[model samples]
Target: MPRTRPLPSNDYARRVAGQFISISETRLNTSPPRRLHLNVNILHSGFVPSAWRLPDADPRAFIDVAHYVRVAQIAEAAKFDAVFLADNASIADQIDFRPITALEPTVLLAAIAAATTHIGVIGTASTSYNEPYNIARRFATLDHVSGGRAGWNAVTTADLGSARNFGRDTVPVHAERYARAAEFTSLVKALWDSWEDDALVGDKAAGRFIDTSKVHPVAHRGEWFSVAGALNLPRSTQGHPVLIQAGGSADGRELAARHAEAVFSAAQSFDESAAYARDLKSRAAAYGRGPEAIRVLPGLTTIIGATEAEALRRRDELVDLIPWSYSLNRLAGTLGVAADTLKLDERLPDDLPLPGGGNGNHTFFHATLAQARTHGYTARQLIRALAGGGGHRVVVGTPEQIADDIEQWFKGGAADGFNLMPDALPDGLQDFVDGVVPILRQRGIFRSEYEGRTLRDHFGLQRPVSPHASADSGLTVNA
Candidate 1:
């Protein structure tokens, strides 16, 4: 049995208890109310590279199971929809200065799921390097272990470091990666749907264990892979773990439109984000999915304080802690230029082209460029604005001010919700849960308590029925 951690202190519990409003009381409008979906991205110590240097931070939190459990507990207490984890198969970061994502996401998430209930656990798994059958089985197990609160953030790896680790001399071309991703995702879904919902029958009296007639083989053969399917497990509680995709290129958008239930977007401004949301939904509609088929959750970093000045001070302190050399190199990687190409006092190079000849991470490249070009920021200024990160929008202010910004983005159709990456972990997440959550609750846009158990329920998504659940499909489970 997984050991359970205690909830917040009694004082905090009472305070949150007082804020709870029943669903009946909040339903005033004739139209359906749009509640906010917030997921905390537990990025090691936190989003900032210097976060591990904080006095209260555990330098090894990136690999500490207890650290993630604590963060998930806080998010669940605050009624956040989920806790998200990003993964890398290689040493993708400046590891000398910060902790890299060292643990596999599903493994870490399983530990987190054991320690908490209610909060969804979403993890990234790259289609670039994984077999479809393995990816499907891994997340299915997570969903079952988490009681249907698992989400897979499907992505394609683009970094050369990841390629070399996979025994490849070069990164796959942009189109090929996305194409493989699309097929990879489809095959995974098919495997998940292999067993009909009622296929299992534990009737010892009748000496029957399963209805073999109901199990179907996917028998998928595509350009990138060939798979004989019918996963060994039954469909999970949510039918399939919530499918998520995070990419900004044209190919990425098409994949999301066809398959993704939620997107972790990296748009820097309201206009850009809203436009992206609109375009993505339009594409989804073209694929015969409804407007609500996908949720656009933009990445947001928050630095909170009692006052705006205090918040700015906090932001400055964290940003200043980052070594300029590290920041410059990281920025250069995103912009596809040499570190020396960027001058602290000068704007980005006027003739910047897409990274890796248009094959690098297009999401961050465009988002970071938009922020710099929009404000005409020098390299130094841009780093400060980004809170020493790459592309996500950072907001530094009091809880109210931060709430106001979130409100604008949520109500303006710029986002469905936010994938939060705080400046530091446990402490930073605690700050938001204690300070920002109450305000969001009072405003009637956020949940005071969870209404359902599954991740699909939290996102207000329907449990999907297996398309292969036919009485006489003339298919059998693969050996």
Candidate 2:
């Protein structure tokens, strides 16, 4: 029998292919063949702790729409691929050392859409704490409002405090949470597809607006949730806003392979990141998907300066600003080993037996240990190097040096792109956009002008349609 189904377009592959073409087609443009994918990881007003304390930093920028808008405008001016926001469901510990997350990402992104154009807005949302229908509608609205410059970063809650706040006695099992996340995503997409792309006719001449036949109810009855009928909103610009995943565990990788177009990830070294990227692509191939179907972007924290000495000074300044106790406890929580078991000058005891199963934070613990082993550093040295964040790669250098590292990694096949955590907020990003982006664009590694719209478009991905809906058919999905 002939095939009943046609092949689906690779949403992630298209973006990668576009970059390859941009690099190869020298005659089409004067730009170089260099391809750069940059995302500003807007973590608590950007990565630097003293960022809020900087003279240029607005104390209340965390909650102010204008601050985000101004930042988005700047990112757009630099022709960045996207701006990413990381969110947690619960406010776990407020140490007064680092800034805590305040404004919700979806709302913040919507406000940002009004202030800028072209740049992709990616937001983190948990499957554990939210209902599928609401999240589906929210992203759809954001996509429409932003003309399709929207993406959803699917996350499963990892904090115990979040479970308590949600009226649960305890956190769900890790594997169980992954199972629910997978299904939750499926439900959300179904809801987005509830209405076909052209469900709205607006035919006032005949007193008809919608074709009810084109609208369908998504009656989902699954182990974790059962959403009924169609969602209130229609499809957004990308069909389904670009699906991004950020879990590093084995289970996490499996989920990314099955669905994610791009993944936000971390590894301590180029070798580690290369292994991760290789594994994800290999898994994708096993699932009968192409290697370019999922883009791997490891998180990187950078302190950039005009010169090497200036950059080192900047790094030292951030290190000096970090409170010892805060770093101590954070590291302790990561290892699932005790704080008293550790001393500032001592080594991480190899004799401390590894957990039989769960540490609640395996990725960081392993990465930190790997960094220590790789660099032959002791506890104090490691803590100083890691600073506040556990194990993401940290680089302090001149703009040219930073670009060189990124280019080396990209060309070496260790990464498809980077999720940048600038040491400070407004200033940190400003220095990068003005100082670094131009060099990459001039080298033909990054785009000077946006070739397409939508988060998927930036990634060279095709818009995903509802599974049941044909290319000609609109979806009628009820959430």
Candidate 3:
């Protein structure tokens, strides 16, 4: 016989203090305690492309497992929800002077998960080149190994460089890529649900390890992919790992609305971020999901110092290290414009065209433009403001000021939380953890200790019930 633990009874007599507060009572006087979710981006060296130039920066950090493990440990200690790793199939930047995304994400995240016990491990995988079954199995395996602390950042590779690496000279049109992505995502979910929760019987007396009748075939035949059946693995602890999306285009938004539990956004200002949050929630509503079902986390890059002047000096050191030619070319690439068209001292072109013929990364392009136009920053100033030559918002300040900025954004409905991209790693993250996290905790917007075991628990998301189980039981499953 299989030994099982007894279930808890609803007995107020045994309730612990501060553990059974009623939602209505708490909501009457003030909003329920709002938690600010944070995820660290473990990019090479750090967000600053020129960070490797620093004497203490490890150039080999791009491929070093120790480097990633240390970062994950720090983030876990700070109670961050997850550690995100972005990837590209092809070298998308000028690698002669800097590092590119070296290791594959799923593999690296497995390593990170092995070292850390709590932090969610998120890895990017493009639907353009990979099959839905493979992604389903890979993430499910990670979830099993990590004890349900896995998340998948679904993305469509947009750069022509990536397409060429896969034997295609030209990238797919924007609509086609997203259309395929939508189907691919749906199929993966179906595969995950192919097995009912109780499919694993493990009945030693009956000589049965699994209830085969409980497992069903996905039977998905789509335009992009035709997957035949159920995933080899059983249902993961979290049911399915959290689904995260990061794109700023219309199609991207629609995809996220229908499927994503969290959306990683690049909005350069409070108003922009607020509008984006509203738009995403509204879109989710259209798909029958409540606003609370999805979290909007805008990317934030912080350059911290003891004083404002010291912070600016640190920012300058990084920007100055990046050559004008490299910065200009990099910025142009994000804007989908020619490098020669931009002048370092001049403002961005008034009528800058969208890159990839409307299929490019609209999120970054729009966010970058918003920041540049709002501040009237010159090309050089814009480059410095961007810090890492990416479109994510960058702030330079003391601990207090940085904490204030984070609070303002969270309270103002601009963001549910932030996806932190520190200017440099280990040290940059350590500064934020030591200096800024205390302020956030004092203000009562961040967690001091992890409250749950899985990534879904950290994000306040429910563990999904298998659709097959719901069907078998004649119950409906909600997103």
Instruction: Please give the RMSD to the true structure for each candidate, in Å.
Output: 7.6, 7.0, 4.8
The TM-score between candidate 2 and the true structure equals 0.88
- Quality of model 3 by C-alpha lDDT: 0.86
Tell me, by TM-score, which candidate is best.
3
Candidate 2 lDDT over 1-479, as tens digits, reads 01112112333323433343343343224633446688888765667555666666777777787877877788888888898888887776454766678789999988887777789999999998998988898887788788888899998887788999999977888888899999998888778778755555555556666667667899999998988969886666567688899988898899898878899887889898999998998888888886657888888888888799998887777776677777777777667677777788877877444332562655666788888777777777887676566778888888888888888888899988899888887778888888878777666778878877677767766555555554433222211
What pairs collide in candidate 1? none
Tens-place lDDT digits, model 1, residues 1-479 = 22212223433322322222122123322335899999999998999899999998888788889999999998998889999999989998898898999989999999999888789999999999999999999999898888889999999999999999999999999999998999999999899888766566555566766778768999988898999988988766666799999999999999999999999999899999999999999999998887878999999999999999999999999999999999999999999899998999899999799999998999999999999999999999999999999999999999999999999999999999999999999888888888898898889899978988878878877566567645343222211
Cα lDDT of model 1 overall? 0.87
Indicate whether candidate 1 or candidate 2 has the larger TM-score: 1
lDDT agreement with native, every candidate: 0.87, 0.76, 0.86
Off by over 4 Å in 3: 1-32, 470-476
